[model samples]
Target: MANKRGNVWIAVSGVVENENGDWLVVKKKYGGLKGKWSFPAGFVNEGETLDEAIVREIHEETGIEAEVQGVIGIRSGVIQSTISDNMIIFKLKANSSKIIVQEDELFEAAFFPPNFLKDDEDASLLLQSFAEEMFEKMLYKIDGLNPGDQFGYTSYRLFL
Candidate 1:
């Protein structure tokens, strides 16, 4: 996965949670993140919006249709020698709890409760940090706070 400095794949993902209050995660089957646990995600196709991509990826990976609740924030990083110049991260909320595994793209799927990351798929510390940041952002967003609002340590950027 040799990365080009300015060229990168456009990817979308779903930060889904179930009734048990656990976040849904999957183990990627192929590519740079193969065998690692991550939120259901995929490359955005030729003609699709970020929201559409997230919905499609969610259904394709988990066999469940999810509703787009909100945008947590965008995260960009380098991997496979690529800079991910056009990457888009989306935080989604789901309505279905009956998740079916799509073996070709993901080996397994499950819900993880907060603070329980024993099966974290990402091995890179950089990605882990990004996940933590996203979670913080999610918390803020779920609590109905403006991420940019100057509310002491309540903001995602400041919390981390």
Candidate 2:
């Protein structure tokens, strides 16, 4: 495990699903990445594995119990602020339906098609850029109809 700058933070996100096949994205209310559109995610607690963090974060943030299907991918990026220096991004595919927001941590919760990030107005520019970049990579992979050389990007693992 790589440590960022000096601070260590591990975060897990769940790509939860509904019966209609739409994915869920939550509007973060506070924190460095606040106001951005993202899947349900949070820090990894003591004695927890990656999957455990995924299940815990999903339940805590979205009020949904998710049975994780598999790993999406892991992303690590630098935090440009003084508060934190790094972020470990875990994307997980989860089986879920009901979503109950924990009020203080999120602003709004909604489900949309996997491509919804393309048209979201409230998503931060950084997030939109990341999402778009990942989406394009995924589209190309799908066009090729192969997962080979396609699992390296952020969107490929998260959007499926």
Candidate 3:
């Protein structure tokens, strides 16, 4: 169900990095990535702007109020033979640290430090591979705006 761009669907995600550089990832309760970790993301609803969709998805999946900073990166490719996958990655500044998991879609959400997928040890090869595939390389950088410059995100983890 793509929009006017001929894409199959639009997947919007928010990339929020903490002061310690750890990334916010969620453990899926179902789907292919069930029990695995990934960024807080979801499909863009009909008649919703990218900005609105990203913020809504983040809050719906993980209880984080984040302000859209700017575009981080985007990846578009083919999936399942003909299905078009258009993924837009946006950097968000979390205004709060409270993490109230959405029980229906996700079971747990946490911040994983960068390089959690290191290949040095004999940890789980599959997990490492998944992490690499999910977030192997970042194609963008940021300047001027720090992690929590505008928002008052004191910590990445906040108990509800």
TM-score for all models, in order of appearance: 0.68, 0.65, 0.67
lDDT of 1 at 35: 76
Candidate 1, run of 10 with poorest lDDT: 151-160
All-Cα superposition RMSD per candidate: 8.4, 8.7, 10.0
Clashes of each: 3, 0, 0
Top model by TM-score, which number?
A: 1
Across residues 1-160, which tens digit of lDDT does each residue of candidate 1 receive?
Answer: 4544337767776677666767778887787678777777777776666677888988988887787765665657765564554555565677888889998778888877645554354533424554565455442223344555466533232211
lDDT of 3: 0.67
Which regions of candidate 2 fall more than 4 Å away from where they truly are?
Answer: 1-6, 80-94, 124-160
The Cα local distance difference test for each model comes to: 0.66, 0.62, 0.67
Clashing pairs in 1: 3-81, 3-82, 37-121
How many Å off is the CA of 22 in candidate 2? 1.0
Candidate 3's residue-wise lDDT over 1-160, tens digit each?
3446554878887776666756667777886678766677788777776767888998888888887766656768786677787877777677777789999988788766647744524223333544455554443333334366477543332111
Error of 1 at 40 (Å): 0.9
1 or 2: which has the higher lDDT? 1
